[model samples]
Each structure stands twice: as structure tokens, then as C-alpha cells.
Target: MGEAIGILGGGQLGLMLAESLDRLGRDTVIVEPDPDAPCSTRRGNVLAARFDDANALQIFFSRVEVATFDSENLPSMPLAPFAGRLVPSLEVLRVSQDRALEKTFLAKHGFRPVKHAVVPRGADVRAAALAFGLPAIAKSTLGGYDGKGQHRLTTPADVAAMPADAPGGWVLEEVLSLETELSCVVARDGANAFTFPVFENLHQHHILDLTVLPARVDPALQQEARAVALGVARALDVKGLLTVEFFVGTGRDGVRALYVNELAPRVHNSGHVTRQACTVSQFDALARILSGVPLNEPRLHTGGWCMGQLLGDVWLAQGRDGGPLDLSAWRDFPDVVDVYVYGKRHARPNRKMGHFVVRADDATTAAERARAFRARLMGR
Candidate 1:
């Protein structure tokens, strides 16, 4: 029998990771709160319990040879007992779970991040805002994603509106005039590391809407982004995968440069295009690392590819009246390579329910086709 690997969350990421593990001839046990989570329906070994359930974790740990988490929001202290089995280590989670800690770690390690100040709970928000300057962004120090727990302060009134009761505090950052957003995913196993091609991402309301592979940037800049991502992995002594998101824009002095925006210590949403564009997908790379296999550099196979996220809004718009989505329009687009639905039972606005990929002769064409297909899917 092959080794049994345990996953901490059973969201779409976990579901995809399990698929990769299964392809590699391994067994998987998913620990999730929802009985109908995407992973639950895909795999047989599921521990349907809250992530913090100690007894459940004990049972899960006993059944698997190694474990990793899908989300960074999980408390690191609770996983301390299983530290030996965790790939990236609890310290990574410790630094990543808090925005202040993550930014400080980047600056301490000589990586350029946006200028920011930490505002502790009940602190003088006005003072921090004044220091960071107007038009800054206030983000929760912990548990913020998909544009939640964030406030844009463009004036005095906005600063005053900052909540004083936020338990996790906040990090106020000077907003930059971005030229573009880029991301790179790196896979490492302590001894060696490999990076994927840089991806240019488009966002809607701070949530990723599309990703273009082989980013439409100068080759030199793309190389620099990949180097930055690899540097992050080495600095963190990471195992499995680490994705670094960057803001390519003009700094305060008016010089264009890349600034580290955030880091995801596991497979990232933006890297989904790798499934069709790369020799080894991000999920496969991470699964291989977790299963004690050597890491291999992922090479891009297609000339052009674009990945479009399918949010719950599409489901609500197309199927709110009840019944599965009418996917008949998909037949018209031959360039559309794949459609991945998460099998989520409920469709609320902005929730990620699925994604699709398009491949073409060039990045521009692929991006256009992807957008058109997404519009068709949403009945736009």
C-alpha cells in the first residue's frame, strides 16, 4: 500500500491536490468541517471535523505519513504537535498568518514591500494614517482574503471610519500606482527549488479574475520576478510550494520597480493555469514534494494560455432558479481546454466556484478568448 497523506483543508485547492496525489499512486485523507466540501466528494478518507478539533487531528495524523494545509489562516500553535510531519514548518504559518509579521519578515530579509505601519487594536488610527499618508489601505493583520477586512483611506473621514474593535489590528500601506500585477509560484524541498513562469494577473474587486501565462512583460523583468520568487523560497527554507505576488509600479521616487505584495505558502489561485500550460502543474509539484519525490522545474508547454476564475456570481446569475449550469455554449469555443467546477453546494456572490482555461497562439488571443468564454458562461 502507498503512503497516506493528510490535508488540512478540503476546499478546491485540497481537491486538486488530492487528484495529483491519486495520479501519483498515493492515498489521501482530507480534514474539513464541511461534509460536502469538494474534497469530501472526491476522496474516500475524510475526517469531517473542524480544523481545531484536537481529537480529530490526532486521528488524522495517525492515519497519514505527512500533512500540509491548504490555507494560511489556520492557527500554527494548534499544529505544533505535528510539526515533524509538516513540510513548510509552523514558523512559515506563524509569519504568514499575520500581515504585520509577514511584511516585517520581508523587510527584515531585505525584500522590498510597500511602505506600511502596523496599527494595533485600539491604537490611534489617525496617527498611523498620517504616517503612512492619505489614500493608504488598511488591512487586517490576520484573516483577510479576497478583499475582505480591508478599507481604503483616501481622506480624513476615511481614516476616522477605521474600526477600533478589530481584534487582529491592521496594517496601513501607502497605495501604489501599479503598472501591473505579477505572480510566480516556486516549489522547493530544502535541497533544491524550482520556479514557474511569471503570470500576469487581472483583479476584480481585489479578487483574481484572470491570469495570463508567460506574463506580458519584458523577458528581463520576467526573469527578475522568477528570481525574486526563488529567493523567497530559499529565505523561508520552504518545502512544498510558495507563491509570491508582486506589484509592478512606480515607487515614491517615481522609479518603476517590483514590490513584494504578499506571499501564499501553498498552491495559489493564480497558478491554476499551470494545469494546462506547464509540464508539471503546481498541485503536482507540491504533491510530489510532500510525497518525498524530488522537485523538477516546471516548463511551459503552450505558447499562450489564460485562466479565468468562475465565481459564485456566475452560478447565481445562471442557475439561481435551480438546475445545473447550462454549459452548451462551451462547444462554440474550441480553444477552451478545460472547465473545473468545485462542486460547491451553495453559490454566493464572489465565492470561487470553478475556473476555466483557454489556449491559443499568443497571450493576447488566449486572454480574449478566455474573457469571451467567461462572459458566455455568466450569460453576459
Candidate 2:
């Protein structure tokens, strides 16, 4: 039998990656605990087991020549036995998984992350945050995303109000005064790297709501963001993809600068619009990399695009339990180019269910139309 690409997590990202691999006539093996994971149920070749299960890893490594991950949160120590076959290496995952380690590496390497202080695990979070000063954001150093494991400390008592337990430690970050959020995704093989266009991100309730391509910032800043993402991929020695989220901020001192917000070691949500907006989609880029296909720089396929997230809330708003959405409203928005609904089993508030992309003459206009499309779908 021929070799296959192994994925460590079977979340939506993994499912999408597997689909892209399939288009290339590549085989994929996924290891995930969820039997109903989108890839597990829909794509097959899944070993329904825990990430660190020794028996699962043994079976998993036997069939695949190389491995990658859908998430950076899994334990790297357990995979040390099979580390030789990992795409980006365990060290990359190790640093990117922990906020403290990620911050330290960036600073030590002369990259500026937002100013922050680390509060060791089991320490008094309130006191540490107080010392850092009020009007801060406290995030656990491990396994946080989409607003999870975050706390806002405004007054002296704000940290104490919720008092989130941080067994994995915490990082208290300085809040920015004002500006936009942006992200860049870099695709790399062993010897070469390339970046997608920088994306302007907007969030609601701390969850990524919309992404605008050809980011609404000075062209120079967009160029800088792309360069930063490629540099970080090189620093990590990435063999797949690395996404760097950024902050174009004016700090309290009233200084405007670009700061590294965080890193994701796989295809990102912001890059979803690339499916229709760029010559090569992020998923296809990674698939080609995994298959050792020669890389070519991707160019704009559309003038501009916007991708809007569809949370489970949209389903609940539609009064459905679990199934395809009522996309009857599509006739109203001609610019809405593509819609994707993941085969997730449950619908709960704030959970990402799927996404849609809109192409327009310009990205800002696409963003506006995407928002309106979602509102219409939600009956508002």
C-alpha cells in the first residue's frame, strides 16, 4: 500500500484539509476521539481514538509517512516517539501551543508581541493582574481560542469577579488603545515559503466574525504583515502552514505600531475567503506542500472578497436542531459566491458551524454585504 498523510485532530480544519487532499488523489488518515468528527464520518480512514493514546499512535504511524496537526493544543511529548515523521517538527508545536512560550520566543527573536506579563499556574491571578495594571486582558497560556479562557480586568475587582482558574498559567496582556486586527497565513515546504494576502479581521464577542482580504490598511502595513508571517514560518521551520494574527495598534502611550497578537500553526479561518479570492486556496496550498508538489506563488483571482463565519447561533436562530441551513435567502445576495456548512452534530451558541464567502468590486463592500447576508439568513 502507498503512504498517506496523517492528521492529529479531526476538527473542521482537518476535515477541510482532508477534502483538499482528496482532490489531489491523496489518501489521509485521521486520529480523533470523536467518531462523528466531520472527517471521521464523512471522509473515512479515521482511527477514532484519543490523540496521545499509545495504541492509536502505533497504529497511526504504521500507515503514514508524515504527520501534521489541525490543532496545536495536543500533547507533543507523547508524539516524540513518532516525531521523525512530523511535518513541522514537535518544537514548532511546543512553542506555539503555549502563550508564554510563544511570547518569549517572539521577544527573544526580536519580534514584538503585545507587552504582557506571565502569571505562573496556580498563582493568584487577581494579584498578578493587579500588578500588571487595570484595563488588561488575561488569557490562559494554553488551549485558548475564540474567546475561551479569557478574562477582562478593568477595575481592581474585575479579575476577582470571574476568577478563572488557570492551571496552565496566565498571560496578562496590555490592551491597545485603537486600531484594526489583521492576520497573514504562510505556506511553507522544507526549502521555500510563501504568504497569502494579509487579511483584516473583525470580531464580535471575541469571536472572529468577518475577514476582509486586501486588508483595509495602508498598502505598506499589508506588505509588512505578509513579510512578518513568512519570517515567522521560517523561524518555526514550518513544513505546512503558519498563520500569524496581528494588531495595528496605538498603545496607551499613543504610539501606532504593528504587534504580533498570536500564532496558529495550521490553515486559518481568515484564509477561508481564499477559496474563491485567490488562485490557490489555503487548503490546496497545504495539500500541494504535503504531496511535495512544486510551489508557485498564488495571485488574486478576484478583485476583493469577504468571509463571514456562521456560528451555531445562526442555526438556533433558524429554529433547527441539526441539518443543512435554509439557504433560500441566497437569491437576494448575488455577490455571495460560496457557502460551506460543516457536518457538525450539535448546535450551541458561539460554536463555529460553517462559513460563507462574498466577492465584490472591493473588500470593504464585500464585508458589508456579507454581514447583511448573514443577518438575512438569521431572520434579522
lDDT of 2 by residue, 261-356 (tens): 999888888888888899888889988998898777777775778999999999999998667899999999999999999878788899888999
| Model 1 lowest lDDT segment of ten | 319-328
Q: How far is 170's C-alpha from truth in model 1 (Å)?
A: 0.8
Question: What do the candidate models score in CA lDDT, each in turn?
Answer: 0.87, 0.88
Candidate 1 TM-score to native: 0.96
TM-score of each: 0.96, 0.97
Which residue pairs overlap in candidate 2's backbone? none
